[model samples]
Target: MNTRDWNETLRSLNVGLPDDVERLKAAGYYEEAIARIDAYLAEDWTKTQNSPYSQGLCPHMDVQPENPTPHGVDVLRDAMIAQREIMRRIPAEYTWSKADAIAEMQRRVKDFTPEEFEMLDRENRMDWRFVEGEKRYQNRFASTLIATHADLARRQIDPPAQPDSEKERCRRLHEKMAEQGSASARITLKASVGMSDEAFAAALAKAKAEGRDAVHVRAWLPLPAACLSQSDIELEEFTEEPTVIAPENAPQRTVCWEADLTENRSFGVQYSYRNTAVYTDPFDTPSAPEQPDFDTEEQPSHIVFTPYIKALAAQLTAGITDPMEKAKRIYDYVTLNVRYHYQPSYFIHESLPEHCARDRRGDCGIMSVTFITLCRAAGIPARWQSGLYVTPDEVGCHDWAMFYVAPKGWLYADCSFGASMARRGDETLRQHYFGNLDPDRMVANSVFAAPFTPPMLGFRADPCDNQTGEVEADGVGLYGDETVSSKELVQYIEE
Candidate 1:
């Protein structure tokens, strides 16, 4: 059928009973239960009409009105009466909207094809009595179908239907990072304490251009610890430095959690969009990946990513027609919004959007999720890439996204590292990370919650999604190493 015809058919088919049926009972029209029951059965028929059943012995024999069976009439009668009873059990305010109903419908059935729409239409308009089951059954089937479809849709990310060349492209990039310095070359992170923004920016720019893999940062003046005691320090932006802060007379007591020592570690700070809590994890990577059951129908779509995510993706794509530009948009948005919130590697994979949303902070894992959500919402296919962060100095579990943008195909975007580069005055990280990924990075888990292809020696499964981390060679925690921050390195050297 043409689009117009299809639209009409869909509308007519969806003319089921109102989502809130209690209103019918309130109006003293208890008999309306029959119509509501019929509407639901009609919807089921339309949704499942194209079944590959026998041409002779149809399962829904009553659906064919000319050959009406006494059994079909009894089924519809029983279902209606049961629905009336169900209404009494629930509160009066309960209701599902039309949109909610459609969403519900999609989730209920797998392998539900377009042809079923025609069947449901015919069944509802003609053999309305053929619908079977009681009131409880009616709700169960409908609820199950709707919930399942939503869950499936949430987990499924439709990558652009391109060729397999994307995989090869990623491999080449990995090789580049693999060969960056001597295979055993040690990475050094040097930083300047108490520097101004302009000066820090200039220093970072020099480091970046000279291939001097180091980050430029200023002291968290006063200190990073005062927040625990709720110290009232006036923070001001310094044109020359990172920030000019006036410290209160309160003693500069050290809060174990507040020390900026995390700066010397691999990943930098983390942040979230929904909450105001910030933390730092000293491990190189966040956590190991965890696998979730694939059967559930309710998935993390509307709840995890806020509406602002969609707007951010659109904003990033403005005027930038190139695939690289689109990638840049994705990269920039994440670094700009999500800051570093760190926890122990053991806890990284367990709580994701929950921790990030409630606390408003996360390490790379959270950043990756936020970035992936925005890209998917904008119709850009993105997936997780988790593996050891193999820097020149150390290796630890790290996380990032592989986005498929037009022309560029698939590329990695590491927002945390890219954001650090931006902070240090290197615009290239912000610009290249979107469509262009770092060749220095290697991917471990190409698919989240699934076993890695070709596997690994003694490869262990992730207990949850986004659980990726690393330990020292001796089997201890030490995420990966970030030898890029200048301010952090200065402190490290002094110690």
Candidate 2:
């Protein structure tokens, strides 16, 4: 085995070594550190199993491995087994306790009907578990299942009245925006796009408003990148005058506002931009690899080049010479291999690429980051861009990647969107996403980890993508304090 492999394997196995070796590591002398570790293992090989080190990673002598580690045999075995589980999705046993059930029985019996309890037990299992010495725990997704699904949300907890449908809430917010008469609401769209916008607003306003969650509506709704794809910019209206409007070109542009937030108030902005669909031919040779900006480098937390990423990139790009083609291979692999699903929020992910590789399932952001890490490992420069997927119908946050190719400049790839198309066997749409994107999108973030203009008050629900604007009141921000900002379409002109 090469010295690098030994060092990486040892590090992965969490083997302990001496201070000088640590100094070598501190100096980034991985090869030298591995060599020293190897020599130590060799000298102490026969005696380590009999010593106190036997309890830990006591390296046995006369055992040679391509991946060498001094960890005890049993320790290494257990570590490998746990690593195997952690490195991939496994059916882990959820331990619920009688104590936990007893504690919640009164509430469960009071809160659920017999049929409702059976329905909850079906596929959408409530996320409840007991930890040793701790109270039974449940998250919002778990606790709100009844309210979110069973229609008891309004009755269960006396929430302020909210628009029942997303469409209605959005329309109400737009009405409030238009009511405020902000400077932003000046530009209007063409007949088609305008009609879409108007219809959306009216429909949202007219929907069957149901279980309400719009508590004290404090929000900063994202605005389009004006002087770009969208045109005829206007600030339709507002609930209250915003503290600020982040610059037209702000990485995460927003109509920042704080309001007294009377019940049912929706604060929003209105703007229209032309959709300019961008495309590139992957068969075309790409520009040679160029040095990436510091922001696009190997961020240890999310995009670090671990051994698995390196190996995967190598396997995927083998025999590919062209950077563009190599990038395409990685993109294709990601879209094809990583089935898209709603990930458990962005904060829980440590190394997104590794998580993607292990779990084999994640949302668009997961697919984007995995593609970024692999392309970077394969020596292709790629970065992140994300925002809202604006349409007359649905508006939600989305993420995608951009890889630089000479002649073509930077091109887009939407693996999640593409994967959805692939599932339909829509070759045209699927391939289109590999090298193009619909103009019907808004970019709020040009780079991941891009800082907010005034900086957020505290932990953002989504620290990566900033399509849904943030909120703060009194002092620090409320993580999920109020309604998420939304959009409406008055018109959409194909031309």
Q: TM-score each candidate.
A: 0.32, 0.57
| Global lDDT of each candidate | 0.37, 0.55
Error of 1 at 141 (Å): 47
Off by over 4 Å in 2: 1-219, 226-236, 258-266, 285-296, 481-484
User: 52-113, model 2: which lDDT tens digit per residue?
Assistant: 45567556647533324444454443323222322221112223343453334335434545
Q: Which candidate tops lDDT?
A: 2
- What is the C-alpha RMSD, rounded to one decimal, of candidate 1? 26.7
Distance from true position, residue 441, model 2, in Å?
A: 1.0
Where is model 1 more than 4 Å wrong at Cα?
1-308, 314-324, 344-360, 437-440, 451-462, 465-495
Q: Assess candidate 1 and give its lDDT.
A: 0.37
